[model samples]
Target: MGEPLRGQAAVDQLLEVLDLKQIDAATFQGESPQVGAQRVFGGQVAGQALVAAGRTVDPARLVHSLHGYFVRAGDPTVPIDFHVESIRDGRSFSVRRCTAQQHGRAIFLMSASFQLTEEGLDHHGPAPEVPAPEDVPTMADWLERYPDRAAAFAASPQAVDVRYINSPGWVQPGDRDPAVHQRVWMRIDGRLPDDPLIHACALTYASDLSLLDSVLSIHGEVWGPGGVIGASLDHALWMHRPFRADEWFLYDQTSPSAGGGRGLAVGRMFTRDGRHIASAVQEGLLRRIGG
Candidate 1:
């Protein structure tokens, strides 16, 4: 939730980022956001890689699941080349593997599965009961309260609107109880196209935002002075239902384990009406840098 790029312009920028340049039937290139970030965001790479994979498959096929690993820290100043492999193209399902390379080194690797629309068993985990998104204080509220962090927040690139039910770790270090569960509300800062792929890709980008933070929650650690250090190691996502990325959704997240310098987090996305839309799991590299 850095810098408020609210509205259609933010959404447009995100869409543009996800739109990869085709280099060949199995290769593409994507640009990193000039957000003054030191390293490319993992979510951006994941979403763009998915876009590259999706581009080579039938439009009728929709992405149902994706698993990716961060092989190296990506340099944000350079463009990433995505080389996709057609693993298989079955009658009803297509599988693809994508490797994101920078400086001739693989920075990320992903395998994704696409499927034709079909009926299936319809059931989902129950959504957690929480205050409506409107009732929660947003990042904007925190910015107002902490005048010192306003500059940093305003300068960061954020295409999504994020509202936390509790104080974000960076804002109020060690303020909350040590717990494994955390909840937040998020949606695109502006309107997006009607394409389901676009929506899925957008959510893919947004999904990485606060996931690892759930791991830090257990230690009452936030990402500020004397905060915890963490980075995503691997990520997996499963799409359950077609949904708009521009609409509000609840991210119910929990961290069940942390040891050996790593932490694992899992989350579920639920629409305002309680429809479960997706599931995400990630293991992050965690080091106690300070408090």
Candidate 2:
């Protein structure tokens, strides 16, 4: 693996990763963010694939839904090529399938659908009542409070800020009193372009973080030193309303079930004003290291 990017440089690298190079019609090449991880982050691959798919469609048609499967762990040192297939184009909808490959082997696959703006009746359930983002301790706060964890999360390449309302699982293993729910306030670290696709893809990348961890909150699973091993198997996202990635949003997550070496987690993204913007569902493979 290459040396890990740091601070604002890492964030710039993330934007470059998403800014794929168009190699050919319906094909693009995306570079991996050099985050010092052995394998490419699943969310990075997914977000890049979505960007590839979005490039092929008309700007008038906004992405509404995307379903992706993590086929294999990707090599972080290698650049990935994404091939998009035009599945269908309709009067009001369009669909594209994207396959991400490294060394000519498929590592991830996604199907995304875009829809033309349409007005219809709309109503959504109320956002969960939680502490305001201002009231919660920011990541910086956590880092200061628990200096040991600063090195781990501070090294993350993505330019997202995370504030946990509850104690992070890594900090409180064996304390099973925490509920199965996980809530965090997240936002892009800096100002982003006005493009809607950029915001959507940024949200997609951030969505993967702290989602599967919902399954561990109830069990108090830690990440290292005899902690559990897990990876996302599949992910699905549905955009319901427009939102900016640079603005604070609440990611409320819950695990409905966990068994058979797999756990299902679902989450909703709500703006600070309590408007539901998107929903995500993911199934992750979870296995204990030692009995």
Candidate 3:
């Protein structure tokens, strides 16, 4: 079993592993795939761009929004250059635009904003009622239950732990009664930094995981062989409040539509206490091709 580290240390280690300056604008690289169909994981690029934006901001402010597009597939072997453009700086907010490049081509572009919190009235949607993380088995446990898929699951770089609250249709693909909503509990498997932005970025990275699949859930298509090709075309996030990534956060997701080989999924991140923390929207290319 891997020993868990503190959140701060985990974030620090991640920074060390993927230092922004080390990323060459002319010749950048990415981590190799342990599993998945794409050569590079979308979450990695999203997370790295967040980190790049985070590095340029004042720590006192927190990230409240981010939008990105994956214009092209990234080569896992090449380091990615992150060019951060300062969009604006104000007393209460700061904005940045970052473009992730590989092979002298733009692979991903992102815009992120940071804001200093202030006293304000609050209102939010109620938290969805579901099984707690403890009530549900860990993803690792599920993989262990299905030994055939354990190796593939173990090799995945999504070091964060996830436990589904409303389990989607796995045994019955394209058959589960279609519902617009889903929820999951997530947190890093190890420790991470105390910095709020780091936690936000980490969440940004984890947010992409399994979100698009919610659309497929409507069709009973689980991520596996013969499941078909699915890739995020664009992603957007809006942070409403501050929260610790080290703690369990509930991600409630809903898919509004799926058509023409595309699907749109929207989600909200809430603290265990029902405090809304962030919102996300994504559209992915979902197509059933040759197995």
Candidate 4:
């Protein structure tokens, strides 16, 4: 219904969206930013659902993983009601289920598990070599270079800075070369409150923005008219190590397969110094505009 906010304003709005209003022990209320989209952003719903679930668990227990399904398109104009269910609580782990509803219908579903911090053996693959985030083209550069996508780049919230290692799927044309992987550097542009749950929720929101890009990259397809259109069907994320979402992180993504009008993308998040932080997987319905 309105234009997107930028800079600190944007991140502030995002924070507001994530701060769900507690209606009762297991119920919370949330709303979408008036960005004029017919459907709410998938990331917003996912983040809000996580917020609701996090509120039900003990603060000492940190989220280790979450899985969510986008059951239906959420109407941004209406308020979203989230109901959290106490699924289970073991000595070291707690699980909760959350559902987002609008107009008496379910729009999203999620389950999250949290665990007490424990010392454990750990090892992960090193981060791939990539240009420093500062060296990558800024959004301003994209506006000047990719005139076709300037509108989108301009409208995007400046709260989250994104620098692509490859052309975005929206900018790719039929003649564009196919790629097996898509690498992007992104971070929340504003500082967030010192809460691990907030940071994790922020990362969960950011994760949804790009996973689908890798899916389209595999086929050299674009988005919108004359290209392929898509919607996220399900998303799952696992946090391996504690990291701040406000800092730059490398999102290395790849698509392994696509069939039956669906594509799966897997991504690994790594810190600048090569520390693997988290992993995300998503499958989306991709329909060719004109097949």
lDDT on C-alpha atoms for all candidate structures: 0.89, 0.87, 0.75, 0.90
**Higher-lDDT candidate of 3 and 4:** 4
Error of 3 at 258 (Å): 1.0
**Model 4, range 117-160, lDDT digits (tens) per residue?**
99989999989898899888776676566676666545545568
Q: What's the lDDT for candidate 2?
A: 0.87
- Give the Cα error of residue 285 in candidate 3, in Å: 0.3
Taking the tens digit of each residue's C-alpha lDDT, what string does model 3 give over 31-127? 4333443467777788888877777778887788899999999887666778888889899999989888888889999998888888888888888
Cα RMSD, each candidate:
1.8, 2.3, 3.7, 1.7
Q: Please give the lDDT score at residue 113 for candidate 3.
A: 89
RMSD value for candidate 4: 1.7
Winner on TM-score (1 vs 2): 1
> After best superposition, candidate 2 residue 151: deviation in angstroms?
2.6
lDDT tens readout by residue for model 2, 76-108: 898899999999999999999999998889999
If both were scored by TM-score, which would come out higher, candidate 2 or candidate 4? 4
**Which runs of model 3 end up more than 4 angstroms from their true locations?**
1-18, 22-38, 168-178
